[model samples]
Target: MSALPRPARTAGRIFAWTVAGLLLLAVVIAVWVGVRGALAYQHLQRIQTGAAQSTAALAADPSSAAPTLARLAADASEAHQLTSDPVWALASHTPWIGPQLAAFGTVAAASDELLRESLLPLATAAQNVSIDGLRPVGGRLDTSVLAGLVTPAQDAATRAADAAVAVQDIDRTPLIGVVGTAVDRADDLFSSVSTAVDTLSRTSRLLPDMLGRNGPRTYLVLVQNNAEWRSLGGIAGAAVVLRADDGRLSLIGALSSGDLPRGFTNPVVALPDEVTKIYDTKPARYFQNLTQIPDFTVDAPIAREMYRLKTGTDVDGVLAIDPVVLSYLLQTTGPVALPSGDALSADNAIPLLLNEVYLRYAKPADQDAFFAGAAGAVFQALADGRGSASGLISALTRAGEEHRLLAWSAHADEQAIIDGTVVAGQLPVTDAHTARFGVFLNDGTGSKMSYYIDPDVSLAWGSCRPGGQSAPRQLTLQLTLTSRAPADAATTLPEYITGGGVYGTAPGAAEVVGNIYLPQGFELVSATATNGAGFAGGVHEGRRVLTFGIDLTPGASTGVTVTVRANTAAGDAQAVVTPTADAARAPVVVATCGAG
Candidate 1:
């Protein structure tokens, strides 16, 4: 192999370069194919698991069983090709309700290869949509493109249908905008609220009464869990009667904290009979609901209540959102301006806090002398050494967005409030109560009640404030309802028990029951209970009887009427009537004589 001609040598150099180029190309192609294959495999795994979980969730849902099952069936039919076949014995092995987009994101974050190839695409898409799709409508920043376009209502519904968790706190409000941004800036917020609500609504399974309304009203009952209500015993309870008569939301009797709040109060360690007694005291108020837990995964109590309303009577919608967290967030974060130039960023503290709740942010703390002795764990979990409020803010933002309930949060202040009308509110039991003395005025130690008038009409002003009774230190863990108004109300109902306001007055049975009032002035009513029937068996025989023998004060014409509902249903042609103050003249013992 001596030196060849010049033409041959040039050709040899070209051939060498070609060979090297081909090798490099081969390596690049192989790497790309491997990365793509891995991602496709991971995605497929997630889909399979997600589908199974969706199917199982449908079966778990009592109210939406049919629809959920139907949807699952349809998905199964479609994804049959994507699923494990006889050839792929591991198809059904996809974890039930496999990882969601967030979970996928998390997993992608862990795998560098997956991140670069898979999540990078999603990030790109999200970025483009965030930049180009988002626009301002009428001087407001509108996330409409992300909201309605990248995330369609139908798709939202579908994702919810595929979720493993149930939606509990659907917002009573629409999406809110404030501070020139949306409170809930993340797309995930929608996923949370809508999904939770859909699940709860489907799971609740309420039946419509003649009025087509589920419950009478959202009764804000305050119960204490102090030593008095517990060791002393569950006594009187209070309530703020919101009579949903034709949707007008009539405000009726407002009892003081001394009365019904004791019934709703829960002990730090023990739950008692007060729960039942609260219900029993006002049986006529059938359509009842408890406010949602301030900041936690939706609990068994809420689920029980929803189940009762959905399957039994048309219970009124619950307005339970953590008032303390809201009060704190509203005051601390200040007003959240919306994308629509709405100044909700500051003013609508109440609704803004509530909407955030629907989306599930960590519980907040008040900047002022608020949240004195409350649990700060939830927020701490959110703040988690972010080491700064900004970090806390970032954590909250991410949490809310991930939950898709953030739309209810005052996240960006420029996004339109998801749905924006605040017709009613559930005062998150105001605060978690410990058992208190059944007596209202007396801490059992005897603290007299104080009053701070509204000045204009002498309405409720600082009633829940002052008085040595302001913060009773006896929470029994057992809860009951009470009012901050109606000075004459009981802190805990007489003869009530634990777990509910149930009491034993009957001749044969050993168990007790509880009841709540149906809404007044409403053409229709509905109701439900948690734990057990009739508010943990607070009813005696079958009646949820509220005996308010209105005494006529001097020149007094209007008296508060207490409605009593019998747990037993009347036969055909026989309508059960709840008595008002006008019915006082009638005999209390009107006998229909059980079915003979």
Candidate 2:
């Protein structure tokens, strides 16, 4: 307490001052780290929110999306800088919080690169063009404007794909909790962007020739009637002839099945064995029955030939769409006023076109006229720029994904691009490692009874065999068919819809010809149906096929289950059902095979 030697006092003062200085330095470092980390986090959140909003807007309205995207890019840039700062880098090497900081750094860098390389270019391209202008006027599209988009879209698509790969390349196992969740979300977002960009790239490359950039082209557009169901969704009850020249599209003619000459000889002499045996060669004489063969590639050419016999002109391609696809398009175009003074909106298009038309018009001629008018009105609305282009594209993309829309090109180059796409409407070429199941329905009642029919399918596998590079498995498939019509449908529904004994079945009953195509190397061990029904088993196209007959009364439901012995191991199995007038509620895969 008392003052001692001067040297000792000086030493004590120096020690106290040194301690204070060290404590202040520590506080400064802690404050700097906390502020920087908080700012980085705020920018990261903004990047995520802005990116999502911009992506949604890009699909619905690209011009408006541009600003949001710009903001997102700016946020991402700031995040990248903050995460890459020297302080953060040194902290990232520390324990506990190090992994989180590293993960943030990776995401920030990837997001910044993606925005600059992909989204900005696309947004810029979007700003220059009007979505409405994408539609053709007087059957002519402004190809020059569309041409300008191809390069930018392609570049963005390539960059997006690369960015997705880069994001996937980052290792996120070290990060945990919120940081891990954020990284996962970023990965998922980029993955979706990659897929969407790939589709855009393909579209840009193909649109020019498809729009008749080189010369005039004619296409046959089949309006499939899902009410009178066929293998490929529905029968070709109505069709339109579309002529495209120099990026302009025009409706040349419309024809219904009744318009074609009856008992005319089929110009197609040879048919696939499956067609000859299952449907008979007379499918050519009946335009509506041409798609009875399950494969669209086989059915499209036959319908085209029949059209040639009827119209004496060849078509360059064929496009098939069901009532469901029309409904999807209506969602984009809003409501269209039909010639009959009836309006068709997205909510009502399917029911009006598929069911009400049959109920309203007993005469085939009147029904045909209504269909032609409705199709024309919708097409005219789209061509006249009445629909949003982005909306239309989204609708079409959704329909194509569900197989409700399909296309076949006569040109080898064009068809090549379509070969593996969902719109190609082909069965899986090979199913060696993966199992495939199909539930295809053809209306055996020869009536509009299909309108009341709802089908669901499920596939379940038991177990894999032991000790092999590729193991065999046991599979079970269950198909459920329900008739949603009123119990008094026989009396309430029109005679045409009830079949009227046209196909030699009971009046007002739903008769369905069910086909199940199994994966390659699969053997039908047994097949059974509810209520004592039977099935015929055979092999077609290197795949096991099962054919069965089912009859359903109003308000009745039945289930058909098939058991199979498969020599091929199952990986990712898929079920392909016939696209219906309504979206299907069937599960794509029921169960996975486990190691025995």
After TM-score superposition, the amount by which residue 411's alpha carbon in candidate 2 deviates from its true location, in angstroms, is: 2.0
The sequence of per-residue lDDT tens digits that candidate 2 reaches over residues 362-409 is 998899888877887788777776667778888888888787788898
C-alpha lDDT of all candidate models, in order: 0.25, 0.77
**Steric clash pairs (candidate 2):** 139-248, 139-249, 140-248
Give the lDDT of residue 198 in candidate 2: 66
What is the alpha-carbon lDDT of model 2 when measured against the actual structure?
0.77
| Model 2 regions lying over 4 Å from their true place | 1-53, 63-121, 124-127, 155-192, 263-269, 274-279, 282-285, 428-436, 459-476, 520-526, 563-572, 583-596
RMSD of 2: 8.2
lDDT (tens digit, per residue) of candidate 1 on 363-464 = 221211111111122222222221333232333333222221211211122112222211111111111111101111111111111110000100111112
Number of backbone-clashing residue pairs for each candidate, in the order shown: 174, 3
Question: In candidate 1, where is summed lDDT lowest over 10 consecutive residues?
Answer: 450-459
